[model samples]
Target: MTTLIETFAALSDPTRLDVIERLMAEGELPAGALVENTQMSAPAMSRHLKVLRHAGLVEQRVAGTSRLYSVRPEALKAIADWTMDHRTFWEAGMARLDAHLALEEGEGE
Candidate 1:
């Protein structure tokens, strides 16, 4: 299982996040395909991919000479689980803020 820190760190980069979103939308794709339509060089993209791979956010498969990349479902699930676990904390904070704002408005009336 991938730690939340690693997963978040890898996704912190915009390029890396885009890569993950693209892979999720388009399914598995060759490294070459990932390089297309981007201003970044293949080497730079490769480095980003390496970070993602190390984070266990993506898996690489070798099809002969090509390297294909795909998002790992479990990695996403882990993130979702973490977020859900903290949902109540956020909801409570929001609720308190709303109540505070209501009190402030009433005070001004």
Candidate 2:
């Protein structure tokens, strides 16, 4: 799994974020396939992949002469876990706001 800081930093870029979203949605793809339909140059895409790989957000596999890329499941799980850790805070805040609104509506009636 990737360190939280590194994972967030890697995802902070729009291109990198899109790359991750694509991989997650489409499953493993050849590195070249990732650049298809994108405006980024091959070299630029390659650099983004390298950054993700270093951050442990992506894994690469050699298939013949091609390199296939995919999102690291553990890295994604780490992110989900981090967000879940804050779920209670947000849920409680929403509950309090809902109650406050309900009280205000009652007083206005």
Candidate 3:
């Protein structure tokens, strides 16, 4: 499995990001289907898929001659877990900022 840093790096590319978003929204898709929606050449799309697979963000299954790809739930869950772990800190900071903004607005009024 790839680390969080690798996952983030893979998703940093717009093409790979689009692929991840599509798989999450549309569920499992074959390689050919993914190519159809993009302006990228088939080879370029394949390379992006390879990067996603290596980063553990997506998994591929062989169905006869075709390769089907889908977002790995565990991978996505890992990201969610990381964010939730930091939730309290950011939430508190945002609340403080919101309060400050409210005070400023009241003073302006």
TM-score for every candidate vs. truth?
0.87, 0.86, 0.94
Tens digits of per-residue lDDT for model 3, 26-88:
999999999998787999999889999998999999999899999998888888989999999
What digit string (tens of lDDT, one per residue) describes model 2 on residues 1-109? 4589999999999999999999999999888998886998989999999999999999999999899999999998998998899999989999999999999999995
Whose TM-score is higher: candidate 2's or candidate 3's? Answer: 3
Relative to the unseen true structure, what is the Cα RMSD of model 2? 2.2
Off by over 4 Å in 3: none
53: Cα error in model 1, Å: 0.7
Assess candidate 2 and give its TM-score to the true structure.
Answer: 0.86
Candidate 1 lDDT over 14-107, as tens digits, reads 9999999999999999988999969999999999999999999999999999999999999999988988999999999999999999999999
lDDT, candidate 2, at 82: 89
Weakest ten-residue segment in model 3 by summed lDDT: 1-10
lDDT of 2 at 31: 80
Model 2 regions more than 4 Å off: 101-109
Sort by lDDT, best first: 1, 2, 3
In angstroms, how far off is 52's CA in candidate 3? 0.5
Q: Which candidate would rank higher by TM-score, 1 or 3?
A: 3
Candidate order by TM-score, decreasing, is: 3, 1, 2
